[model samples]
Each structure stands twice: as structure tokens, then as C-alpha cells.
Target: MKLYEMRDRQSFGFSAENPSGSKGGGTRGGDCEKLRPCIDIQPGETVTLCETQGPGMITHMWFTGYIGHSFILRAYWDGLEEPSVEAPVSAFFGCAYDENFADRDGNYPVLNSAMVLVAPGRGYNCYWEMPFHKSCKITMENRGAQAQTLFYMISGWHGAIPENSGYFHAAYRQEHPVQKGRSYTVIDGIKGKGCFVGLSLAAGMNGHNTCWVEGEAKMYLDGDRYPTMNYTGTEDYFGGAYAFGNDVYQHRYQTFSGLYTGLYAILGDTSDTYNHQKRFLLYRWHVKDPVYFDSDFRMVLDNLGWTGPRYDDYTTVAYWYLESPAPTPVKLPEDGEMVMK
Candidate 1:
């Protein structure tokens, strides 16, 4: 893997030709190197290396947070010159939060009432993939006074999908208003076998008190009816977890004769720890049917040990024929098993 490292004040230039001399006449010559685009990242900004590509181009990103403050990352491609994708600065899946105010530890069963953003002084992570464009972005922010750290990894995939496919699906830990209560949300205008399947746990008070829950949410395969998931409080599933910072995983799937996109997340949350609210993580994979069933998929959290939660949060995994030539096949483990870093 060819990985590029970027930090504050660092600028990378992409151009067409050499900048030394021009070809024609006395008019100071046109610099052969036509400037592609200048990715100007501010003090706390992260961006992709390049946006435009022929096809089958995948971009990967990894980020580490400093102190406890929140940061934002963005990616842009297609219609606009500027990157349009944004995400938070912490190791969590969505939004960013304080690193102090008590519930910051990685081991907590329930989140603090304030961290849920139910009232003032609370916020959630934001991630988006622009419609009609090949771009993605993540942003993180801490609404409190404390500082926090965050890590992230991003990748772009270049593959051909079946024709007639017009929708994309994604999964992530939904930040709710309470620790033990059940919350349900509706995904608007989606059709197909799309769903959210994963485990929810209460990371209680700095890894002290913790609990577990399991459930799944789904929508239709065609662009027809909307999909929804109902979380029950009795199931012991609440809040979210931090997996591998904020990550992006996209795959192409097929339904009957139509094609669709599937995206899901297994995330961790620590918004209700004892020290302060900070960090979120995610683990994701793209695979086909039999291979997916034989895969060992698991979720792991850092700093805090597993609190005996038996909920397996694996979303719907299926197969879809591609419209373009198949790329190199990447083999996945029979059983989905992931190790914590």
C-alpha cells in the first residue's frame, strides 16, 4: 500500500507538466505544469491526495488526534473545486465531544445526560457523501471546555457496479438522547434489503459499569419504501462505542435484477465516561454472500476491556453482480475477527 502522511501547514502540489521552461516564444512562455489544484489545509484540516481519476481509484486516510480538542476533515471531487466531505476530529464514528467533564473514559456503561447533546453544551459527529458527486467528508467538534484526541482512516474504492443502481447506503453508531432508553429513526426514501445490524453497549463511568444489547435496522432494495430500525430498551443495547476512529466502507451489492450500494458500521461510544466525553471508532468490510457468511466479523475497543456484551452488530451481507469488469478479488477471513490496535 502506498500511504501518504500529511500534517498541519503541509501542502502537496499536483500538476500536469514541468515548471522550468515553456515550449514556444518570447512571451515568458506558458509554464508547462498546469496547476491541478492546491489543497490548502488550515491548522486543523485533513484532505485527500487527489480527487479526479479515470476509474477504479480508491483513496485511504488515517488520522490521529492531539490533546482533546475536536477537528474536521473534508474531501471534494466532481462538480466543485473545493472538497465537500467533512468529519469530526476524534477517534469516534460521529461528532466530537469534551475530554474532561467526567465521562471521558473508554469504559463506561451509560453516557452522561449532557454528552447526548439532548440539551446545551453537547454535539455529535457529522459525516456525509455528496449526492451526484464522488466525494466524502467527516467532522468532529467538542462542545465543552475540555480537550480530546481523535484518529481516523479513509479509503476510496474504484470498482464497477451493475447498471440501473442509483442509491447508496451507510451504517454508523447513532448518538441518542439517553443511555438506557430506546431511540428509533427513519431513513428517508430508500428501497432494498438495506439495514443496520450491530451491538450496543453502555460504557459506564470510566469503564466501571457496562451493559450490552443487539439489534438491526433495514430499508428496501429498490428506491421504494423507507427503512427503519426500532431499538428496545429491554435489549440492554444503548449508546455507541469507539472502534477505529471514523472510517468509511462502501460496497456494491445486487438485488433481483437491480443493483444497489451498501454501507454499515460497528461503532463505539464513550460520551458518558467519568473523566470527559471523547473518541469513537468503527470497523467495516465489503464482501459477497457465502464468503461473507464464512467470515469472522468482530468489534474491538481500545483502553477498555470487553464488558461481556454478546451482541453481534453485522449488517446485511449479500452479493451483487458488477456491470463493469471485475477488479482483483480481495479475500476476507472466513470468520470476521478484528483485533484492537
Candidate 2:
């Protein structure tokens, strides 16, 4: 965030050609053309992209592939046993539902934000400053049944971190049908000091034909009985209102992406297949106004105003920063549990 302040650091990069990220990475083959630009990730395989001792920060990351939904991304900081960053590849880059309604030109959806960006035709990019004190390691796992080709780059600077710098973390959760009585917990059990940076949310109606986005967002900090911070409506939390720019039954679901808020993906809408089920992708980044907690933190979304056999499915990814690079207990959904019909 210190744009004007220059700091001493060593620049490094990791890619298929430079898997180790050494000084002369791309020259292993010496003057060879198209030398190891992509990697084939087989089923049930994990690839270690970066593993370096660091008092450093990851400035940027880029990945171009069709393995978002099938591939899992995990990052460990400060030599932790568990990863601080854990989510599906596409979901972490602001597209929770992998398949999006194509644009007018029949291309992929786009998400252009301050921290994450998804270019046309499946290019995923991130600009979050991930810092670690002792060490950092990032890995990608292909859990799908088929093989996937991936071209990626991880770049950063090795330097001294500020004492106040917090470590980056991400966790993914999903609720199909949202459960009649239970609300959707975006993230919970974070028992430490940190600030909630933002979240990516995807919703799909399971059966009902009525508008299903009347839920509201709530934030519970420091062991509160009720939420100290709450929003008027769920769409309002993501800077959208009146059912995400269109009535669910009548019009095409519009898409948008901004610096801090976005409704970027809409799948199988009236404009697409005209099904009763309406799926959406949305996000809101609290870059300017993060929800800080000193002791503990949790947040949830209320599934208000509905009583029927039909309900909505919700997929959420919570991004935040912790005080240091320590592992917290996190249970992620298994591959079988997240299969979209």
C-alpha cells in the first residue's frame, strides 16, 4: 500500500520454465523456443508453485487455464502445516461459479477489481500483497477427473516486512439450499486479530421461481450476541439493489465489475437457457474500510423471508488478513460436495 515509499528487496518469479525461480530461470534449455511454457496437471495431482524462505511479499500472480473449478489453490505462510489461503482457483479470482454466461462476442466473463482481475477467455490475475515473515509456499491441486493444461506465473519481492503488515488469508464455503433454518456463515472461528478484506459470493435458486436475493449481510466481531455491523440487504452489501440490476423472472441478468464491488457473472439466466434456476456471481472488497477485530471475528448472511421446500444455493469465499503467518483450523468442502449440476 505504500506506493510512494521505495524499499530494498530482491525481485523473483516462478513459472513453468522457472519452477525454482532461480536467477537464470528461463535459460535452462538455453535459447530454446517455447521451452516449458505450460504444465499438464493430471487428476489427483498437486504442483508446488513456490516454496521459498521469505521476509517477503507476493506482488502479483497470474494463471491462464480452464481448471478453475476442478483445481484447488492453497498457500502456506511462515512454514505453517495448514494453508492460510484455500479456495478453488476460479472462485478465489472472483468467479465462484466456473461457467459464466458468455458476453456478446461469446467470450468468457470479466472481473476487473483492485485486488483481483479476470480477463476475457479465462485469464486469472491477482494483485493482493501476500506477505510472510519466515517462509511462504503455494500449491495447486487438480482434483478433477481429466487432465488440465496450465500456464502460470508467481512473482514477488524478498524484503523486510513492516511490523504492522498482516498476512493474507482466504477461505471458501458453500451452502446448497442454504438450509431452511440455518443462515450462511461466510467465515468463522478466526480466533485472532485481523481485518476482513472482502468476499466473493455466488447464489443459485434451487427450485423457487420468485426473486431470491432478499438476504442481508451481518458481521459479528469480538464474540457479540448479535451482529454489530449489518447491511440493509444482501445485494446492498455488494453495491447492488432491486434484485441485481434486473427482475429475476423478466429480464437478462446484467454483469458488472468495479474497483471494490462487482456483480460479474450470471449463468443460465433468461438470456441464456431461460431456466427457473438463476445463478449469479458477486463480490465486494473492503479495501478502504476493512472490518478490524482485536480478539476474534465472524460474519454471516441471513436467509430472510422465505418458507418453502425450494431454497437457494450459495458459494462464498472470504478474504482477510491475520496478525501473523499462523495456521488456523479450517475445513474445506470435499470435491464431491461441490459438484454443480
List, residue by residue over 186-211, the lDDT tens digit for candidate 2.
Answer: 99888789899999988877665555
* Tens-digit per-residue lDDT, 1-341, candidate 1: 23474322211212122111122311333567434211223443333333443222222333334412234333333334432222233222222222332222322212222111111233232222122234322333333234444333333444442333222222222222222223222222222222223222222122332332233323233332332222232221123222111111322111110011111111233334354422222122122211111112222221222453232222111111211222112222111121111
TM-score of candidate 2 to 2 decimals: 0.91
Q: After superposing candidate 2, which stretches have Cα over 4 Å from the reference?
A: 1-6, 28-32, 100-106, 247-253, 271-276, 305-310
RMSD for each model, in Å, please?
16.2, 2.7
lDDT for predicted candidate 1 compared with the true structure: 0.26
The 10-residue segment with the lowest total lDDT in model 2: 302-311
The C-alpha TM-scores of every prediction are 0.33, 0.91
RMSD of 1: 16.2
